[model samples]
Target chain A: MRTYGNSASVVVLLAWLLLPFATARAESIVLASTTSLDNSGLLGRILPAFTAKTGIEVRVVAQGTGQALATAARGDADLVLVHDPEAEAAFMAAGHGKTRVEIAWNDFLFVGPQSDRTAIGGMTDAVAALRLVSEAGAIFVSRGDNSGTDALEKRLWRAAGIVPAGQPWYRDIGGGMGAALNMAAALDGVTLTDRGTWLSFANRRGLVELVHGDARLINRYRVIELDSVRHAGAKLGPAHVLAAWLAGAEGQAAIGAFVLGGEVLFHPGVREIPPGE
Target chain B: MEEFVPIVLRSLAVSLAATGFAIAIGLPLAAALALGRWPGRPIVVVMVNALLGLPPVVVGLVLYLLLSRQGALGVLGWLFTPGAMVLAQTVLATPIVAALAHRAIEGRWRRYGPTMQAAGASRWRALPHLVRMAARGVATAVLAGFGRTVSEVGAVLVVGGNIAGFTRTMTTTITLETSKGNLDLALGIGLVLIGISVAVSATVLVLAGERR
Candidate 1:
């Protein structure tokens, strides 16, 4: 018993000794971002450049775009990098964001099993492809997580004039892009995923891109700083620096230069301002 | 693997600190429940035992709100930090430690109570003696608490935000790497986590054997 007591005390002492190392840090900013960007390894490739140049370490909390916006709305993050334009507009209009700037752009792709049961291969129109899948009752794995890709998928379904909620073929898996893709592979179903995450994803399990090159498939990423007036503790200085750096020449170059397996994932450009900006 | 060292060390530090805090708060509560004559002792015991099954994600959500900038405790700016992660883990671990320690200490208290009372020792006064006598059982309880915290990913993921090089732990890193489709790295981290659990359990068993 005495030996046990001594061991417990030693463990507790070591814990106390290492506690400070876990908490101490220099200048840093919390950036709530979408899982697609993080899964694509874009941030992993480009964030170090921003940190090295500005000496401000970026701690990214990757979630769905909806969750990322919600996190920033609650003042839990200094800034946000997400691709959901409608949700971003709602967040800014609700007075949660100080500034919003488009940083980079990617497009969503419809991917599924290589067998092409629905024969959506080489389809350029997403709405038409989705309608064909719905009519054929083919397995469709929906992200169902309120992510940017999920939002776009829902919009395409609406445009197709099909309500797929209660359909037996629509498998709504409330998960991330990669999870949705894995599910699609397992069930031999189809799912919508961004170009970035799809390119970097390794567990394809015989899944292949089936549909792309639609104008409606464009996914634009934006960086937004939290409103300092509402969130008094918001790290506006570093947030502003990071946001500006992302839209600046150096950051744009970094985004464009990030390539995976000989393919550029994202295009760096602010083609147009957000609605009501 | 070099990058993983810091993640593993941070996970150990965070979980250990939370377990230490839980033990600090739990042992006394356990002794009180086991030995003291209180009006609401049964209710307190039931509550603690029930809390043993508290969902970690709910705890994380509650702590996230309390620590958010818009919430009441926002002044501390602990959200998305290691401090918040520790608090969430402590909340998760305290009930396990207290309830299990209560069972261990209660048995020793019943066996040693009459002698201590005959020697004119109060219930509070006998706490240390009872705890020492029940050290092996209490150590087991502490190990259980440590194991729970070390293996938990839900609460830490929600509260710590899984920041790289900061709040990321072994379990959270596994979750992140899996989502990123880095199956090799994720499995490697998972193996390390299991190895740590095995090592700690073996150490405790060896110590218990020494007592015999």
Candidate 2:
């Protein structure tokens, strides 16, 4: 009986300790977002200010843009912050999102080893540089995870009129931006990466930006509020609050203010115009 | 880092809570399986034993499907929370504790069954005595369950979403930092986790020595 009492008391104590975790906070919302945004430390830098101002806790689940959209589609998240415009349009057309707004923009860079084997260094034309890399059969690491970056890479390959797939020079590692960058560093290969993640990444052994400022290389990040009518469990109020806050002046300033190593990561206040305008 | 302390504390609290739930459900099932004579007893024992090898990722995926907003149990809204992580860890640790406890209690039942039966003790009546006599092994089984829950990252990662300062455990943090190419921070967290494992093992050894 003594042992039973002691164990029962211990169980009660554990339950007491876990009670807070079992309950949901009314002002809290889940934001499904991309690894680029998270790995860049941008969200870490700005989210605390949002939370402090609104008293709303934002829990971010950082995945690829495709997975982030899919997570919101499944009603697992109240909002999504991603950079894949085509996928975001498709998700909106599918009625998974109520509202979408572009919050920031960053350009992608063609990064490769400093050896410049294909002589793509200081190249302004992304398509031509990719063609050179492809013709030279230089090792190119691909994200291949249906992320926004992967989508852009596919488009670039299409423009170059070359199928790097089934070629030994192309390494399609279905992973995040950081993973692709790490692989690129390890193999001394070339890869496309967002400025944010590339700036924050620390494992670069010999990689350097080879191509940038192409019209097709702009990466735009947007925040979408999940449709509460479709998903009853969606924290619509808090989600709307967060979405509005992100597009508003304070959030835009915060995004602009986020810097790493004396370089601004994202340009804010780029509103998305309605299509067919 | 200043954040390291909270992460360690959260990991301990979550795993400890999960181990408590595993013990609450597993010990009775273990007792019943080890001491009772029932139809399909062999199959039940075999199934429990087989479940000992259940993959954490598979368990995580299934639990994710079950707890997602589209899932049947979605109304409970447990996904991406510490609650969900605890539930996943409980599912993972339960079978381990049960199978290990079953093995230990079965051995005790084999040695004491006839004598207890001659004294008119039914299996239910003899359960407490057997458990008490096999206390050391049972404690080890509990420790094994704790170890499993503390070290596992897959299930928690799937269900908890690895939200910083919320559902992030030591293993999940290590995974996240490594993926972010912060190998030094990841190694630091890994060393902390290893230190914890070593401490738990030392405690187990001390208990064993005391029993001897």
TM-score of each: 0.94, 0.92
Show pairs that collide, candidate 1: none
Q: Per-residue CA lDDT of candidate 1, range A1-277, in tens? A: 6766866866875565455456544678889999888777888889998998888889999999999998988878888999987888898899888778889998999999899978999999999999989988999999999999999999999999999999999999999887887788788999999999999887888899999999999999998877888877778898899999889999999999999899999999964455476
The CA lDDT at B31 in model 1 is: 86
Largest DockQ belongs to which candidate? 2
User: Using TM-score as the measure, which candidate wins?
Assistant: 1
Q: Per-residue lDDT for B44 in model 2?
A: 83
| Candidate 2: regions farther than 4 A off | A1-26, A275-277, B118-120, B204-212
Question: By summed lDDT, which 10 consecutive residues of candidate 1 chain A come out lowest?
Answer: A16-25
Residue B63, model 1, lDDT:
93
Q: Write the per-residue lDDT of candidate 2 for residues B1-212, one digit (tens) a residue.
A: 22888788778778888998999999988988898778998898888888888899999999999999889889898899888988999998998889999988999999998999999998889988888778788888888999999999989999999888788889988888777778899999999998988886676555644554
lDDT of each candidate versus the true structure: 0.87, 0.87
- State the lDDT at A12 in candidate 1: 73
